[model samples]
Target: MTDVQRGTEQASWRTLPGFTTVRTYQPRWLSRDLVAGLVLTTLLVPQGMAYAELAGLPPITGLYTTVLALLGYAVFGPSRVLVLGPDSSLGPMIAATVIPLVTANGDPGRAVAYASMLALMVGAITVLAGIFRLGFVADLLSKPTQLGYMNGLALTILVGQLPKLFGFSVDADNFLDEAAGFFRGLVDGDTVGPALAVGVGSLILILLFQRILPRVPGVLVAVVLAIGCVTLFDLPERGVDVVGPMPEGLPPFVIPSVPLEDFGLLLAGALGIALVSLTDTISTASVFAARRGEEVSADREMVAVGAASIAAGLFQGFPVSTSGSRTAVAAQNGAKTQVTGLVGALAIAALLVFAPGLLRNLPQPTLAAVVIAASLSLADLPGLRRLGRQRRSDFVLALAAFLGVALLGVLPGIGIAVGLSILVVFNRAWRPHQAVLGRSEDLAGYHDLTFHPATTHLPGLVIYRFDAPLFFANARSFRDQVRALAAAEPRPAWILVAAEPITDIDTTAADMLGDLVRGLHEQGIRLVFAELKDPVRRRLDHYELTDTIKPGDFFETIRMAVEAYQASTGRTWERGPGSYEIPD
Candidate 1:
């Protein structure tokens, strides 16, 4: 076929009849969405501020994050109920990037600028990645690695928030020192009475509500109770650390200034943030899409997330990703469209404008409690257990990621995860499965490979099936196995490779196969290929290996090869070429 006709045929295959399904958009589902939106908004308000604090920025920045992300993602995002905003996952990452650049006391303005720059960089990266359909890059961080990384992050967040909960300040930058500071403070009983009482009370309320109410917003309830108690008793005056007055008015749009010296530093941090953010977003989107029986375009979702982050950055917000908790809340509350998210954003904006004072009396301990409680859900013990049970190698990967985060840092942890995932890929490719196959007499029209030791090889012919793509990693092993098979006693006159499972052949493997074919030809044996995919065939053709092998040697199916062999032999051979024959 001509190149144009071949291209057309490939395009037609992608849109085959069975794969073309339409999406059903239901506008009527919005009738009860307002109530759901209200519930989600209530939960989002305090959580947003808490995450902003976690990100080492002013709490109001969290409000800005909620406004822009919700609106932006609602319009472009694929998921109807995915709530995008300030995320705990991105909190430590932002802090890691911003903390080193700013002064010890923290430059609120400069921090905001840095955050915007990081957001812009991340947005650009995501958009470019989406445009290039590089969504598969997220798979570089294997599931085990993510589990470990999250566990370590949860511990770090819990440790970092402890001082705030006790109304004491720690000057530690890293996780180890922060943990040590927490323990020292605990041992010395440096906890402020009012802050400790409020923190412990909030924790109790959240725990009780979660156990009893189950469906209600436990953290929101805890916040309300804590704030109400602190306000009624005037606890701040008695030494309780309160959030104190928040800035009013909408976030004004301003371009962030980047220092020429720090451009490389900021860019590197942004790349790390972008990769993790995309990984988290795609994963969360896939989970919801699967539940709804909806298909998610990962590349499109990346664009949506990128747009949200860019909008947020410009509007005085930091990096954001899809929140599993918020998405669950939206889904459970029956959100049917992005309108619910838009409504939630409107609600938060109203809160920021009108009730800014209400947050002033909110105790820092209560906010810490909120963060600790939210992070606890992200620990993912069940996922770790599942990984251990289903995939042992992945279990080790998860452990490595967890330890990397705990012992090293977020960046190092991510580096370890990616490295481990790549190693796993290479390990699999290095030693792919190869098996001898034969026709099954007991089964109708089926080929079965005898895996038991009692089965013996047939004389004069050998059939082998390679269960992976032919690549440079395993080319040497492939050559060794083929040579070994040819040198065996009662050497096979014909060696048919069941190429159905071999998806692609690299240049190195193609050259090795060509040499193997020539070697076999000199040894008075023929090398045949059966059930080769068009792509693999094209690669062989490109390498000029097609001319070396006779046209009739490349059978479309193993059955065709068996039929051809029987016709050539014409002995009514008791069994097929590779099959063991029993004396009758």
Candidate 2:
């Protein structure tokens, strides 16, 4: 099909009935959506407060974030079931951004203002990225690297919140000081009384509920039970610190104060925040989209999340992203449209207006327990284990990211992870596997490379495959491989490159291919290509390499190429080619 026709067909398929499987949006679905919203809101309430604490802001700001972000995402987001709110992945990120400019626990108003400005900056960046369709940039961080970074961030957040759980605050700004302070507090052990009891009790209950009945919202249940216990038994009189009264009603829209002197610092911090927000939003959206058998538009999601952040900034909120837990809840509850998120936002709004004080007496330890539980879910132990079993290099990358977050901090950890991922990419490109492939002995009508030591390769006719895109990093290696193979005994007159796996080619690779073609022609050898993608073909054409090689040499399939070459040479083969005479 033509490119325009294919694009039109794909667009039309988007409107088909089974495209999203969200047909029959009846009232029953709405009722289920409302119930799911209430369940998620219960969990979000304490989570918002805890994440706010992690972000170096007052607890009420968490509620403000929850309400505004929920409402914002409901309108613009494409995922009908995705729940957008304050996220644990973004907690340490925000803390890293704001803690440097506004001292922790030092001027609360200035901290909030800086946070709001950060949100605005991040929003603007995301919107611009969406406008320019830069969502492909997120692909820079590989899945393994992202897994490592998230595991590291989870550990940092879990440890950082421990001091609050113990009712005494530490003066640590980053992960190292937080770790040191945690150990110091452990050594003292003098401040451990009602708060410790409440914290430990809440943790056990949450863990138990998670293990015994995962369907139940353990965090929400723990919060309610903890609050009831505190109120019924007067635990606060015995040194247990409660969350205290939260201001009711919505946050009024106001412009954040931006100081000229701190613009550079805030801009750098906002860049980091924008990256984290984009990474987390796309990752979560892709997960849900795959489960629903849908393809997510990365650019569209960027616009949705950008608008959500802008709305959040205007209403005294911080950065927000898609929450995996809440999205799973909505999907499980049979959410059929964006109405599910709308219902969730309305539920939170109603709570903010009428029942803001309901959680006033909620124990700080309980909130900590909830945050810790949520953070633990992001650990990704299975991914770590798979890395260890599959590739040692990936295991090292994961460990480095973990240590970076635990010792250095969130921003540094992300930088290190991205660096490691890039290093891996370069390492592979620099020395890509160029295997001699042929038909598998045991498999029928299929081709495979012989990686085993005992396997033998066919002589004269060389069929080689490179596993990565041809680029500047590996152009020299490609030339070397072709030269070395051409010099081997019983030199092949025909060389077929299995180019199905090569998805891209840079100018350097194109130039190298042209040189290789001329060199092979000098030796009276035919250079052929099979299964080349259209993009690669275009690159070759652009560089005039296609004209250098005969038009008949490019074949759509390896089987076809092999057959054509054998027929052209008038050779009948019982097995693969054994040897051939060099053209003199």
Candidate 3:
């Protein structure tokens, strides 16, 4: 190859996230990865099938999604052990999007096509986000809100699947109505006894095995048992619903055939799916990486997951995300590289090609049991308890998200949860805590005077600290607070701002600072900044405020500012009263 062509190829390879890991692969790790992959396959098979049903698609679509998504992620995913697949958390989201557009005639093919389009759109958005290095977009969904959303989602999934578990169905519009309908079914003797027996029995076995023999594939065991009983006894004739025959061979590549009129709804659904999947993937990847003493690049993860989604979409499957449970299973089984994921994908593909009817007798209730088990894990009751004990407001926010999902449908609930999270962020920024700085003999640096009420500030020097960044929302409050402090008894000569926490200074804030500087200067008081970050200082410069405020007014630290004040005035102020050790 020519030199320019070779260099271009190398540069292109450099952009692929997992290329470095693949290049550094060791042969010794292969045996362990292969074993882990085989072990993971047991769980992945049942999970993919179950989640596919949850997504309102044929069980075989789950296998197709599982195969392609794993292969795609293995090629581009950055993490050594993150396993991507059909996720239970995203199943309802897929259903919410595709169910409405499906025709009254119940054309499953068109439904699948629309869902594929949503996945494609989500994949494009995620890829563009990664290319632009907008990984922080995931941070928009805060932990409290995420916990609440997942908890709500768990309840939603559980409630929706309960009727199916009992060999029945509900035609309600919302969660409460559906839940009520399920109860009415039970009261009216509408539930099938055989299906309920299989489902409940399978659920109990799965739960018990999980508790007693954690490493055992309880889901697979339970599913196999259910299938065996149904097949041997001819349970279908006894009013039990089985998955029946799955499509044989590989998934055919199909371009989505959605119309232009429905593009807006699909686009909205794609954004929601992308946000949830991206947030879940990054968070799950980060947790696993941290456990292994490794680092996670969120942008790279977006690329990997986006690639997986696109690959799945191309094969007539819905979106996929990082599976925390499957990845944990892979880790516990000693997964050493992306080869583990590749092996699992190959195993599923082989199953589809060679053993398509293996699970033909698998009861629908058993599948529902599998889904209910997975959904139960995402409940996060302990996390909620922790939040309640540690932070009340956060707990309330989480509760809001839970209620939003439980009361509204999945799509609207996600919108409500995300909106609530953003509002909480804005609320904190709008009314952030500020403090007047004072010194204690026991502590080396300045502390909040409210907590150390007996401590005193240096006379005629007002030291103030704003706990949040200076922005348009809080600028006016900051100005008023500083003005109030200046008007207190024993007027101050200088105001030194401890600005370490003020990481950003927007245009509105800079303008407010300019007005404050002029107002303070008119009253024989000079405004000074200590511990201000370089970037924030540069912003002040851009606003042309640095020219008006002398260069000498800036200090690297609070101590330097204090020393400068002493040097100019020759004052040694007396220390405050409180001298005891502060309790944390």
Candidate 4:
């Protein structure tokens, strides 16, 4: 290719993910994308409105969030078919962050502005993270921690919505308080029977459709049917609260303005939102990419989702995330590219402009039911069961996370989960498993001496295995274990370390090793290592331990180390029953 053409291609490759997708756009995929977009629109409309309500924003703002986020993702996203929109998981977070700041003012517009600014901050942080290629931040939430957080969030959401589902307005804070209010309202007979009927009926229908039909748009059908029933029977006159009319046009382009005094609070909330949003988006993108046998660039995904959040904020909407249900609809309906998302956005916009009155009679409780259904899916009881059965320690961590979120509020619960995740990682490394190696008749390779009582150890030789990286936290433990082995009654002349699992060695560990070597030499017990990695060996050289311990002390394999020990001692070896061999 020509140099100019090659340079242009390289620049294009470096552009946003959507640009690359569009550059290689296939004409035949347009029809499929259009169909997928239409199918996705069904779920988007109801979910957008419901999640917006969940976030304590006007229902119309959900449409705005849905449209702008989808369009933004379509223009910048890396995935072929990921959908971005108002999410159930993020709704409570946004509400918690923005509500307190705006509640005193009692100004709905200011509340929206604060939420939008929060989204803007989230966008800025996420974009910066992407620019710096900090995709590893997603690993902050380990699988068990994530499952626990989700389960807790799910319970909180479900309980919080119970008041609305029962057709009563309860003024309370936190999940437990709200639940108490719900029960009190029930005892007082404050719930409107008609609204309760609509909500419970809608939830049941949606669940049944999901279980039986699978292919049907259960949420859309339930919502539409509920709206029709309410409107046809004049349920509003019978005490059912309706969504009321919404503005019939696109969202206005406005810069969100927040009070300077509240900037710190917004910043704090934004950090939490960004963490949750990016984690959810990256995870959803990874899952979809894996199913299609494609690789997802975490940095690119971050940039795409960040751009979507910024777009939503600029359009007077709160932050958004990858929606599992909407994305599944797109994928199941044959979405082929980001074009599907763009089409869905346009479809939502058209609905707002032309048919805003169609859902005016939709019952509020039914919307709550929709959100509650989504929250139910997030519970993940089966995952908890699997963790309990597979790894008991992980199960404890997961259970702790679940309790933290369920009992505490969402934001505080997330903080607890993060701290616990760090502890779980540190605990593993701080007290990692160690073993002594011996030849066992039943095992192919060397087995742990303590586990195999009948296994035999070489005379005057001790093969110790430290199965973790040597760092400051564990360095002392390593020294203690080695010294204890040396102090044993049958003191070994040669202590050979199977260093294959010791991937890294830090400065503290190097110093510890230096001390260990000098102490072992005084006892006439040689300290040797077998199968040390090149990087670790280089680290030892840098520490000047190579001069203290001769280069010949390190060997490539256990058998080679044994051979060298025999050669140094001028000993002869022969094979017999229950004996080991040294290969030439």
| Highest TM-score model number | 4
Candidate 4: minimum summed lDDT over ten consecutive residues — where?
Answer: 575-584
How do all models score by TM-score? 0.89, 0.86, 0.94, 0.95
Model 2 per-residue lDDT tens digits across residues 82-106: 7887888887888787878875457
Q: Please identify which of the two predictions, 1 or 4, would achieve the higher lDDT against the true structure.
A: 4
User: After aligning candidate 1 to the native by TM-score, how far in Å is the CA of 36 from where it should be?
Assistant: 1.8
lDDT on C-alpha atoms for all candidate structures: 0.82, 0.79, 0.88, 0.87
* lDDT minimum window of 10 residues, candidate 1: 14-23
Candidate 4: segments with Cα more than 4 A from true spot = 442-444, 451-454, 570-584
Off by over 4 Å in 2: 1-28, 286-295, 331-337, 439-459, 521-526, 531-538, 545-584
lDDT (10s digit) by residue, model 3, range 350-428: 9999999998999999999999999999899999999999999999999999998889888888898889989999999
In candidate 1, which residue ranges exceed 4 Å CA deviation? 1-31, 444-457, 566-584
What does the lDDT come to for candidate 1? 0.82
Predicted structure with the largest lDDT when compared to the true one: 3
Can you list the residue pairs that collide in candidate 1?
A: 144-398
User: What is the C-alpha lDDT profile of model 1 across 1-584, one tens digit per residue?
Assistant: 99999888665433321111113445576665787898898788888999999988999999999999998886667677788999887888888888788878867999998998888888888988987999998888877787898998888888889999998978887889998998898899888988899998998887787778867998888888888988799898878988889987778997788687887877877887888888989888889999999988888888888988999999889888989888888888888777788889988888778877878888989989989987787799889999999988889889888888877877777778788888988888888777767645555433445443223333566677778899999998878877777877666677778899899999999899888899999998888889999888887888888778768889998777866766775524334444432111
RMSD in angstroms between candidate 3 and the native structure over all alpha carbons: 3.0
Winner by TM-score between candidate 4 and candidate 3: 4
Tell me the tens digit of each residue's lDDT in model 4 across 119-191: 8998999999998999888888899999999999999899888888888788876887888888899999998
- The local lDDT score (0 to 100) that residue 369 gets in candidate 1 is 91
Please give the clash total of every predicted structure, in order: 1, 0, 0, 0
lDDT of 1 at 313: 91
